[model samples]
Target: MQVTNQPIDAIHEEVFADTTSGIGPELNLINPQPESCRQISAESPVLSNIELAKLKNIPDFEAATIPMLYKVADGGAGLKQALDAIFAAADKYIAEGKCILILSDRGITKDMAAVPALLAGAGMHHHLIKNGTRLRASIIIESAEPREVHHMALLLGYGVSGINPYLAFESLEHMCADGMLDISFEKAAENYISACTHGIAKILSKMGISTVQSYRGAQIFEAIGISSAVIEEYFTGTPSRLEGIGLDEIAKEVAMRHEPAFAEQNIDPFSYESGSHYQWRNGGEQHMLNPETIVKLQQACKTGDYKLFKAFSKQLRGSAFANQNLRSMLTFTP
Candidate 1:
């Protein structure tokens, strides 16, 4: 959020100029391409070399207008190699000691914790970053999705309190524009949204409130004897920038289960205690159907249970495709 109107071209040159002098090795300097020379030289003063490198590698980095989304390939030396390449690419550009933002996939998040290595790779000493305000940087290894990206873009624009969402988005966008990642904007946005929703659901379940029923005065209504109204208040009061963006519909469905009306509406046709009805009081609402029904649905989805998965997918109105939450849980293997 803290940025100076320092000309982008000036910033770029200052960063590369000092480092480009008397370059001793290929790994030490980036050969500034002519295309890069014509673009903005200066960047926001706060970005780090590594962060800028990641941004520069985003797909279509040269002309990225929309938000960028980078994909970290699953389970290979691919991620490490990609990181190395990006660093190599930006070594000179970022050497100017500019601050840069970096948003990575969850898989690479652990790497951020190893600050020492990052500093070393950027040819800087650890102690140099001791000043908090001067070296301010953010590394978030959060879920990525199209909706999440869009929401993040909006949040970055909002700049509430002291939280600046744009740094993360800019890092991500730059990386995407630069072609360092193999992910698409839409897919990234979807993944981001799914991460947020599922993450919140997971957090709520741990708190014994499995459903998020509202975002205003009585959001996140719980099962059992808890009041749905209180949960709504909690959610609305939380002040998360993500509150109203892409989660309204999800909240309504999750909250509906806790409503007294849901209890009355659910009816069982079979003679069993669970019958055909699902109740939210006993974590039933956490799921879209009765627990007993879900058990069968899980089985059906697994063993080529196309008939069941299809029907269930229909009932859930294609959430399987949009969110893939159920599909992931059911397809998961040991």
Candidate 2:
């Protein structure tokens, strides 16, 4: 059962191909008109929609009010203070009948060290809900791939109402700036947003859901490897299978990832883990689809050898690629 030409690379390229061609037509779905859905903008200094459309408006959504965007510090001791302020702000907004809060994690680090903050935000949202405050929570993260989408779904199960993957937009900007992409920044951003929306929609569809509103805070997922203590606190009501790392462990993990950024700050203020984005480069960030692994997976797929594919996939499951690519979709029993 020999397979044909290796299509893994081609499939990867196609999955992330330029989406500019279909963006304009999807604007109505991405940013619904005020009449279609109540929309609000928080007057704040942040990434311009020219870089990424952070706001999402769906017509006839369940929510009666639009969300107020809130940006907070990425991580550190200051994170607690920032979350306190965010909670206060959310209280005010909820009192004012703004039932949705958009927690923006753009301009954050590549490792997603802000997961703790996201959990804290979810906790606050749940607190409000418990106190009879009618409100919802959404997140704007730097997610890119299908695995990232699954992570977002986890957040949704933990109380996230919506998600926007701004990293996809930033990747587009970088590609266009590097001349690897021919589209303008705005067009690329639009296309990226559309792509993320499509990805999220597909995830929901798999669960027999037809709309994002229905999926909000549904807790439709099970945490396989997370601590019960952490789950009890931030992810209340959510079930965890294995006893995993706790909040302290999570904080330590985030600190470890942030250490390099702080240590090398003097060398470059805007320094980041190189190759953490769309392109895979050495000594930058962790990625699943590196040249070596992609080559191996491509070879296995081309040969139609299930055993070969399994070997490559076993390696992938143990690597960072497990959380960044659509590895679940590549299952082969043989």
Candidate 3:
């Protein structure tokens, strides 16, 4: 947990600035429109489609009719049917020379892997090519990132052209509505989407690629805990460094997570996870900010105790707080 000398936020801001300034030919060249931009909202705490559309128009990026394929109710069979239908429709669109396709999981809560599976299946389909040229249509993912951005990158490496982190946008909307965030809904949404785009850019840059198009299906990563069989059947061409679980194991993990909510027979009011962001909660996933450690760090700074500050710094360097934005404010003078 050694903290970088430069703060993560500052690094991100610099990268974002560079991206916007066109410092690199790949930076800020193209920004994809999220599916949420289609919704019209008056009192809602999220940017309406109209506003985002206006922004998109500034860059001359028209929102095209990107067909959405949602997850079906039945298991694999249902998914296959849905994929077939989507591919069929895609063939029609490609024949018409459409430039993009969107796959959405707006109301889907289970079998989230189906989205990537469908994407892989689409990549395998012959209709994606015409006249010995790959169909120019890009596949954008619209329902992702309640899990991990790495997973999103994995999808991108597999064949996904763009990503719209809908869940993260919804979370920002909730935060604004609950007074946890002070910014306007539009700004929050914009900032969050910008951050996500920056992240994607960073991921691409790491692989020495400047553009998202090149990053698509680059397959630069090696999976650690997925089985070879699953990789071969579904996540084809992606290397699995360590052989582990198969698709059944992955589905079992998904089922275990789903069972908790499904078992709740009576509807009850929902509460946000304690320490939802910026802090770690008991029985919850880890976060970068630790309340107790932050308090101690503040105390050390107030008292001007160099020894105490060093101790606190050492402690922080070992915990998740090393990555927290507050780390930028800490300057070590030795």
Candidate 4:
């Protein structure tokens, strides 16, 4: 029930955490609807170099500038290498009087896979915390991965001071140019940020949290499918009861994205995969409430047939697909 637009707190090293419930239909970040997320949006001042590239026009974003930036040597070096490089850069940056460290996947190439931004951010955070030097400087992310509220919340929770959501901004620009969005690009980007902040507030309010300072690094939820080893290492101190996946799963997921990004095949770059998270897509991710189930329900309603209804219900609830939730993992015992 508590709420505040401006969050005030002295966030030491304990401001980053991985408390999200990982049992979504896919392995995307899911802020529980019940708990209210704090901050709404990060209000802290962050210095960054991204202004030289993208994000040069947003009002009130260019508060400061970064003197030094760190990055992985190559994107095709695999996930482990990328992480190692990031951690190494962390130590060097901290030692060199650098106040803001930028972890970016922008240098990744097509030969190898991409490291999930969540992993990079969370890994660097814990690494710094373990070394007892996390509070030395802030972390900023310059990537194309984060676009939605949940994505931004995860970044904030994992200890990033600010995010240069260049991809999201570019998408808005494209939408404006293509007439998909009625407003100007700047207005669309501002609205997107507003939407993310409000969405995060809704999640924090569900958990009864009042501010981003309290919510940052709080690790508010439990992991449903991720493994304990992964949580201990990256999400450290967060709960993973099911012990589901490890680095292998994460690597595979990253490859799924990396493979298509640089493929030399003849396909439209704009024709991206229509992931069926909300509405269903052809040859895409399967959803419980898909068109097939909807038609069956309609047919059963029209005929008043119990058997038809049962079939529809069974298919809707007990079907198998890549998108798995906690609901399908449960069973009744005698």
The candidate maximizing TM-score is 4
lDDT of 1 by residue, 216-251 (tens): 012222222223332232122223322232223323
What is the C-alpha lDDT profile of model 2 across 227-322, one tens digit per residue?
886677566777775687765565666677555754633666356544456677888666777887888889888888888788777878774555
Model 4 misplaced regions, further than 4 Å: 1-77, 299-303, 316-334
RMSD of each: 21.8, 11.4, 11.7, 10.1
Root mean square deviation (Cα) for candidate 3: 11.7
The stretch of ten residues in a row with the least summed lDDT in candidate 4 is 19-28
Residue-level lDDT of model 3, residues 254-324, one tens digit each, is 44444455454664536534435444777676554466667777888899888877877777677455544
Name the weakest run of 10 consecutive residues (lDDT summed) in model 1. 19-28
Ranking by TM-score: 4, 3, 2, 1
Alpha-carbon deviation at 81 in model 4, angstroms = 2.6
Flag regions of model 2 displaced more than 4 Å: 1-85, 96-100, 105-117, 136-147, 265-334
**Two-way lDDT contest, 1 vs 2, winner:** 2
lDDT of 1 at 119: 15
Better of 1 and 4 by lDDT: 4
| lDDT on C-alpha atoms for all candidate structures | 0.31, 0.51, 0.51, 0.61
Count clashing pairs, candidate 4.
17
Please report how far candidate 3 places residue 322 from its true position, in Å. 28
